[model samples]
Target: MKVLAIASAGGHWIQLLRLMPAFEQHEIIFASTRQSFSETVSSYKFYAVPDANRWNKFKLIYMGAAISRLVLAVKPDIVVTTGAAPGLMGLLAGKLFGAKTIWVDSIANVEKLSLSGRLALLFADRTYTQWEGLATPKVHYHGNVLS
Candidate 1:
């Protein structure tokens, strides 16, 4: 199976990497905001998308377009992300391109779902929260990556 795994920098990226073992035996491509991250997953395909946050409309549009292009090119069977805004964009792109999408919310949001997480629940095929307390009927709790 071909899988596209994406995330923003820092904690989101780290959590995404920790899920790699589950994707063993598949062709996995990595995407992130930092070109420097290509070194982290040197064995697999990698692409860099422009970084953007909710507050920046122009950069957000640019980032979303870049992610859409990447999704169309990869045509992955599944798209998975540990997110900030970029990863949510990835899920939306993947969904539009006929891929199953999964979003794993960053473990840092302890008290509530992050803003992106709330939006992701509407689109992602499967949504996960690292904290059990955050799980709802639609969202799931499967422990955490950061320990």
Candidate 2:
């Protein structure tokens, strides 16, 4: 099974990297925003997407397009993400392209989700919360792999 691992940057990227072992046997693709590690991540099959924040319409549209292209190209069997806006876009695109999706809310979102997590819940085939307290029908209580 092919897998696409996605995140934003900084902490989320570190978290996604930790989960890499889970899908090592599969074809892997990585994506995140352009950050200091941009060049580093490029060593793998990585993609650049716009980073969406509280309010960034242009970045959001660019990210959506980038995700569409990446999804079509990689054609992953599954998509997994650690929260942030870009990851949410990937999850949506993955589902649209007929891939199973997994969304892991960042440890930073223990008490409440970031905006991306909200969007993820609507599209992710399985949504996970690092904190047990945040567990809901749509969220599983998974301990933080990033921690």
Candidate 3:
């Protein structure tokens, strides 16, 4: 399977990395906010998209366009993210392009889903929370990267 894994920097990126073992057999393409972040996953394909947050509408728009282009070009069978803003953009593009989408909420958000996680529940094919207590009919808790 072709998997497009998207996430922002920091904890979101770290959480995504922790799940790399699960995708070992798949062809994985990664997207993040900075090229420096690529160093950690040097063995895999990586692309850098503009970084944006909920408060930055202009950057978010730019990121959305960039992510859309990447998604169309990569044409992945599945799109997965542990995210902030970039993941949401990937999910939106993946959904529009008919790719299955998975949203893994960051482990840091123990008390509640991140804003992106909540938004992902609207469209992501599968939504996961690290904390089992956060599971609901719409969100699931199978396992976590931390475990």
Candidate 4:
């Protein structure tokens, strides 16, 4: 299986890195905004898309175009993400291109759902929540991400 692991830099990237073991036998690629993330995960191709806040309309359009290109190029079997704008782009792009998508709500969102998590719920094939109490029809009790 070809898996596309997506996240923003910092903690989101760190959390995504932990899932690397789950797909060791399969081909994997990564997508994030930071160049250091690409350097750190050099074994696979790393894609970068714009990281726009809700205010930046132009950047959002740019990111959407990047997402389209990414889906066409990778054609992954599965798309996985840790919450953040860039990660959300990957999840949506993967779904548009016919990949099974799994989204992990950021560990930072202990009690509340982040913006990305809410968006993920609309399209993700499966959405995992690390916090035990955030029950919702879109969420799965996956236990703590660090555990």
Local accuracy of candidate 1 as per-residue lDDT tens digits, 1-147: 999999999999999999999999899999999999999999999999999998999999999999999999999999999998889999999999999999999999999889999999999999999999999999999799888
Worst 10 residues of 2 by lDDT: 34-43
- The C-alpha lDDT values of all candidates are 0.94, 0.84, 0.94, 0.85
| Model 2 ranges off by over 4 Å | 35-43
User: What is candidate 4's lDDT per residue for 74-138, written digit by digit as tens?
Assistant: 89999999968878888888888899999988778887888889988999999988887886767
- Give the backbone clash total of model 4: 0
- C-alpha root-mean-square deviation, each candidate: 0.6, 1.8, 0.8, 1.3
Say which prediction, candidate 2 or candidate 4, comes out ahead on lDDT: 4
lDDT tens readout by residue for model 2, 1-147: 889888888888888888887888888888888656556656678777678765878878987888889889999999999968788888999999999999988888867876778878877899988889989888898587865
How do the residues 9-40 of candidate 3 rate in per-residue lDDT, one tens digit apiece?
98889999998989999999999998998899
**Model 3 Cα shift for residue 127 (angstroms):** 0.1
> Which model is ahead, 2 or 3, in terms of TM-score?
3
Score residue 77 of candidate 1 by CA lDDT. 97
TM-score of 3: 0.97
Better of 2 and 4 by TM-score: 4
Estimated TM-score for each candidate: 0.98, 0.90, 0.97, 0.93
